[model samples]
Target: MKWTHSRLFLAIVALIGIVTFANLLQSFYRPYLPTITSLSTTNRSDVHENISHEDSASRISSGQGVKNKNLDICENPYLQPGYVWYSNTTEETNTTWVPFYPSLLDESYSSTTLETTGEPVDPYTSDGDPYFPTEQPPQELLDVSPHPWMQDIVRHYKLYNSSLALKQGGSSSRSREVLEREELENRLHWLRNRRILIVSDSVDRYQSEYICNRLGLELINSNKGRQTASWCHIPMWNLTLMNWHIASVSPTKPAWWWIQSMQIVNVEERWTEYYLPTLNDTIGMNGKSPDLILFHTGLWDHTYFIRAPEAIGGKASWARSLNWRELRFYMQRVRMVITMLREQFGDDVPIMCRSVTLKKSLPSNVSILNLDRAARFVCNELDIEIMEFGEIIRGYFEFYKDMVHIDRGPLSVLWANMVFWYLFRTQGGVEVRGDLIEMPSNGTEIVNVAKEWNTCHGDFMNAKRY
Candidate 1:
């Protein structure tokens, strides 16, 4: 109990060192707060480390002066590191999604219930907000979840599923896994039980599988698909992906739904009538619509509907996929499809039209550019959003698993992130724009806050990330 003067001095020095190290750790994880703020909602979370270090976007990247200036929680909610905490309960119908992000629990927004209320912070049962575009991509080819929290999802999933992570680790790893499980489980509770509808060819079917797998769930009960509409459901997560097989927005032949005998009469017009009821039976009617709807139809159309430029029925001679007449018709059909979906799902759910994905061969490629143009045109006109997967992987034939589907890798993750981005936009009441996320071509987009410590932003980023 008797301490010497030298002992006391050493103790004080040690205390200062510990405090400095802790502060350094905090800065390493979250460099700055609120690069941009959400303009729509009021109850921004004060829970997690808020990071909005966005001045890098305007500054352009160089070796020098990687300066950063960020906004606070009052401005943009979707900026990095800062996320809203949501409460989830076992009662499926009781959860409240973030419709708008106003501010960091601003005094003006007492009506908001998603934030903390002096109770134990059981986010799984608290009202929560939908968040997204969480992934900021890079030039690297094999990207995973684009945001830090989402990266946690992948880390937890891979580690949990791996043989080493599951079987080899001892009590230390087990304890770590237990803590991680609780954290990730509470964080991802908002996305579970949310049904996502994908109406396209097999590519989206793979995409659905990726989304489920990324979330540590798997799609099961698959039927004879890859040609017709088939689905796989994960009841544990209450997540369902429905893929309706339509080659064209306009009717050309029988659709590839489970019902092999789809009538060809006005098929495009009638697609939704059948699709919705069938989806109702699958995901349930209950007046509850899917949380997100993604659709793109063209590969089948090119192969079956669009006539050959040189020969009316000759598929080989068709040098082009879009003529003025066909383009007009394509736009009309897309509009009809979107209109039908809007009427059925109501305005709450997000409806996104995926662009026509690229194929490897030139014959198949001839029409994709045109097809994409037409799809984008109609989607833009109708206020229906577009997911430009095609544009992202354009000309990268090696990324294709086959002639159509994109292989599993960064491309796949990007696809899921696009879906997440659109979902948040719709749920958050944010205006949908294609170029909202900062996509720098120089491989400098920073999901990890530390990487940006020295990276320049803004006009300095390349025209396209490699």
Candidate 2:
């Protein structure tokens, strides 16, 4: 009986040893086992599709998912082109550019104390300390409003910096050097390496400041003083956005280059001396000259020099009532400035003359309107392009922050879209809408956008039913 019991105990011990050995061997091979995989690469296409459908606003919150590694060759982007203004107010199936609403919900987005600095903030990343828009925007529109312009900027900003919105060039497996060369092609292709110069007054300055902030350019060194130049550059793309405050397009001072080149140019001394040297400095500072030049000058000329009201002693009207001599001289200078820019920047370089913005004050407003009409005539003669900046903001005089500047929130975003959309359209990345009218090249009368804004806006859809 003792022997049988001892044999049973040995048998049980042997069974235990076999089970332990099997488990140990299985443990060694556990990692190598063909079990479930946590990697979801197979779902990447599905994820890409899902992310694509979500509105541009929610794109920011989508954290750490598999990114579409391949930069897509952007063939057709949803850029609507029209002479009339558009919005996505009623939630139509067809998306308008207005659809990009930035939704960053951090409370830090709110403005704490009112700042009267008079410069517009980047609606995308306003810290509220320095970047706050004037006197704190209407809390109603900011806090609970459906379309937060500030938040909306981020959506577009991100799209421009991403793979989704297709820019006009390149598709290839390339060496680093080859890739950079391809990128340089995107300068004119996407306005990436391109530089633009805006030679004007304070009106343009507000837009420049806002644009720099929106695009992540450093602004600490930007000059805010009158008649001086300010610069913003991004090295990665080699883009330079420069604004030269030649407050008076018809400079009282003669330009050095003009004096040297033309023995008897115009009675008005050239501003080339002051403005051109500054352009040189801009080129030196950025290691590149401007690819495009946006030129304007009217308000300062109207108030400061052009029209001083017919004095109590019977002098002349205050920048209004049409000083024929000064107005003619103004037109001549407008002609001269364009001629000078063409001569200096080379005829190949495209120069766009903006339709002069109307100052809110009456006498000046009339003077400004005349300037716009006169400037348009010159632009047409010079074969230059016009950005209906005047047309876009003329009706929104109520939105004028300082009685001069108009676009701050979504309007500023519109400014960016207008500028860049022209680039995209001209470069063949975007197509013009068949529905809207192009600026009448042969417009006989000065296009009064202010009077016609409402009528023109309804032209496509309202007429669709009619």
Candidate 3:
């Protein structure tokens, strides 16, 4: 009886050992199982599809889960053309130029009236000019020189060490070397001659203005008073001719010219009466006939409450209920504008959209639920290419002064570099660098005095000389 009991106890111990061993193996191999969820899986796909279809407000409120790993939704084999991934890193490294054969070339070259007027008058007239003229000069005629200040600016912005900033004596040779390394001179020269338009809200106006000033292009604001009826003409012997109309305000006429408009609207205002009509008007007129339309409108919409006027009391309520439904309606309006632009401009016109910028801290009555999730849902539904501004600015938060605006120094340099990199990738134009010119960093020292007036205070009485 004692021997039988011992054998049974040994069998029970063996079973326990097997169970322990199995658990250890399971824990060891758990990490080796797929860390990323496959989008092809039935469960994940269904969830994503539902999230994508939800109203922007509902998505904002619910804060749906987004698989960060599967950002490249347009990567499928049957993807449409002109779906660009706009990133400074990717543009600098991964982009390759493909010769774009103009679809209307055969039709355009055959027309005589169009050539003379610099406009498409008739589609059928045959002219002596070759159909689909090429504008880029032969590789030999192209100048591949870098701007003198290109290196200094790049170093100041990119080189993190303050010691380098102070110790590094500004050298023309060093500037030349930097420019040569990045091929900035040639790139700038090409860009100077290309017609490009920048349309943005107040936040991006400084960058856009700086770029225009640096490149010798006119800057026009969308605000009514700032509008100017000026046309920018680029003279190139090869088939390259571009015209620019930079306006902060929506254009009065349909943009029939080869215009590339950058649309950056403030999304924060209430959509019921004031902001919606303005947006609709802008979209109706300027959204069509764009060669490349870059859309960015997410920052202002989140983090703030939009309160309707109370019927009984005059005072604004702190616990004012938000009109999220109205917000989603405007978002859908934006989507419609995108669709119309795609239809009018054709699918090949590159549409680059931007995600909302991140705030350092959350606002009162606002949670993370209202911002990023809404942006992701709208982007998914619209089928637009997203430039992940939040992710890009994560490491470089110091570049920003406040919640939204960036410092002028870093902002200008960053925009210039981005534009340079983008133009390089898009095969738009080479950099144009003329004689080396140096100006004061700040415009404080002006030799000639314009009438000194404090516009904010409306005081022109005091005139002091520096």
Best by lDDT: 1
Q: What is the lDDT of residue 465 in candidate 3?
A: 12
Q: In candidate 1, where is summed lDDT lowest over 10 consecutive residues? A: 136-145
Model 2 Cα displacement at 57 (Å)?
A: 35
TM-score of 2: 0.49
Pairwise lDDT winner, candidates 2 and 3: 2
Q: Name the top TM-score candidate.
A: 1
Q: Name model 2 segments beyond 4 Å from true.
A: 1-189, 220-226, 251-274, 277-289, 305-319, 425-430, 434-466
True-structure lDDT of candidate 3: 0.35
- Compute the lDDT of residue 380 as modeled in candidate 1: 67
Question: Could you give the candidate ranking by lDDT, starting with the highest?
Answer: 1, 2, 3
Q: Summarize candidate 3's per-residue lDDT along 1-466 as a digit string, tens digits.
A: 9999999999999999999999999989974554333333333323334323222233223322221222221111101121112233312221112111112133322332233435343577555433444233222111112222333333333432333453476533444444453543232333332222223333455555554444344544324223221122222201111111222112122232112242322222222222233332222112433223445544433322232233333443433334577456545755654565456456544454544455554442242234445545675665554434333444444556675565545434534444433323222211212112222122112211011101101111111111
Clash numbers, per candidate:
34, 16, 20
How many residue pairs in model 1 have overlapping backbones? Answer: 34
Summing lDDT over every window of 10 consecutive residues in candidate 2, give the lowest-scoring window: 71-80
Model 2 residue 175 distance off true place after TM-score fit, in angstroms? 27
Q: List model 1 lDDT by residue over 1-466, tens digit each.
A: 3578889999999999999999999888764433343332332222113534344323323222211122221222222222222122122111111213223243433433333334434567554434232222221211111233335446556545663555555534545666776666554444454556777877887877765666656654334334445565655445467776665665554333223454532445446544544666334222456666788887766654444322433334445556788778777887777787767766545566777876777775777678788887787676554555665456766557787777765556556555655443332222211212322121111122112211221211111222
TM match of model 3 to true structure? 0.38
Candidate 1 has a TM-score of 0.56
Q: How far in Å is the alpha carbon of 254 misplaced in model 3?
A: 27
